[model samples]
Target: MADGLNDQRTVRVADLLSDFRTLQYYIAAAPTEPSHSDDYYCEGWAALRQCSIDGQHILNCAAETRVPRVRGGPDEQAKTELQQVMLDSFSRRHEAQKIYLRQAAAQRWVEWRDSILCGGRPHSGNASQLASCDAQLRIDLAAITDDSIYSDMRSSDYQMGRWTLEDPRLRDVQRWVRARQ
Candidate 1:
């Protein structure tokens, strides 16, 4: 146990490097734009969010290592280099976090869209059921329309597909319901 402190620093530095690389991979793999599929977007976002946590942990580890407990330790120079590398990686990781937030906003949009669109396939296909679905959907939409996130989403860099951005929202589902009636 004489080398325990050195061993702990070694382990922490190794963990920091591993997490740094994982953060880079997540940033590289991140979608250029949000996907239409909720599952796809959610899965990707979850991975990125986890990486964000890892990145933060890396930063914390780097800070701890930089505390200069023993200035002339054998690995001091190596630790200094690692700290610089970690700092550089952190900037890229911050950009990844922005992407993560935009994706979360995009996912919210998808959920709202799905809530309205899923109303079309009731088992009964009866007018009463269709009307009930529409009523609930309208209420749901109304409840969320005033949320400022949608406005931020409008200004965000990602593109919503043509089908989603069309005028008179819920057009497709409304048409289907009218046809059924």
Candidate 2:
């Protein structure tokens, strides 16, 4: 949110920190399963999104109901101290929430690695085809990176005489794929 020394995006530092946690939620969810799902990751995706919504809701509610600012007075002094205590309490809760989300995300990532590396099909379609050369190639290139390229090839567009495998783009991609192997 900060731009050099100013708030470039006009976003508060607290908001930026919260957004970072939301990203963390997504990363953690990957291990839980389905961050690599076909067409859609389903469960992991939904959970991460829900985590983001929940976090945002918490932040927004806190902001919306912020304690009144203290100015000056013996009475105001006591109010200010109370506000400080509440703020500290909220900070602790926020930190706890962040920790929970981070741990959840890390656990999911480890699970995804275990499933993919140890012969479990966590996601269908290409994710399940990780063991085969041809399948992996298609998964990484056409399916994962370029849906149109994969679909066109699957629908016999190459046989239409307009998109030959010998084309430079396809050839280079094929070469790159082979090189990785």
Candidate 3:
């Protein structure tokens, strides 16, 4: 999706950086309300996933040796620019990944809420079937929180440290899920 930033023309680092910043702002401002459409969660999650991919690509580009004659060669200035761009992309990606996790939790909370409202069981109601569904959702959540994204502190390129800060909305959702369980 972001290939255009690198492929459509000369790698315009400024344009790429602008795109990253815009996405970061969009993700940060995304609605966390339950009343918001599923589209918001879907779009945000997709965007974050794409950001992770693009961030990794940028990191890889930064790590590669620059040949002297091809693609304008590598210079000290170019290296520094790449470093800054990669850092910015990764730093934003890390935060966006956490937001995606919160969205997943919120979506699950909504599912649980619906199930409860339907008299402690979903329409499918088969224990084995529900177990399978739960497993799938858990797997999906795990993917978003995977080591490549947010779960591993080592993967955090920016010194954000461990994800220790609490998201109050997430906490409330967790509490509700536990109380119902």
Best by TM-score: 3
Winner on lDDT (1 vs 2): 1
Total residue pair clashes for candidate 3: 0
lDDT per residue as tens, model 1, 53-155: 6444534432322334446565765555444333333333333344344444434544553454474432444546445544544443344332233343333
Sorted by lDDT, highest first, which candidate order results?
3, 1, 2
Error of 1 at 170 (Å): 43
Residue ranges of candidate 3 with Cα displaced over 4 Å? 1-31, 34-74, 119-181
For model 3, residues 25-69, the per-residue Cα lDDT tens digits are 554454344343443444333444444554344333332234233
CA error at residue 160 for candidate 3, angstroms: 26
Task: Report the CA-based lDDT of candidate 1 relative to the real structure.
Answer: 0.41
Q: Extract clashing residue pairs from model 2.
A: 28-105, 31-108, 31-109, 32-108
**Please, what are the lDDT tens digits per residue for candidate 2 over residues 79-116?**
44444333333242333244344445534543554555
Output the better candidate (2/3) by lDDT: 3
TM-scores for the candidates:
0.32, 0.32, 0.34
**Model 3 TM-score, all chains together:** 0.34
Best by lDDT: 3
Q: What is each predicted model's overall lDDT from 0 to 1?
A: 0.41, 0.40, 0.43
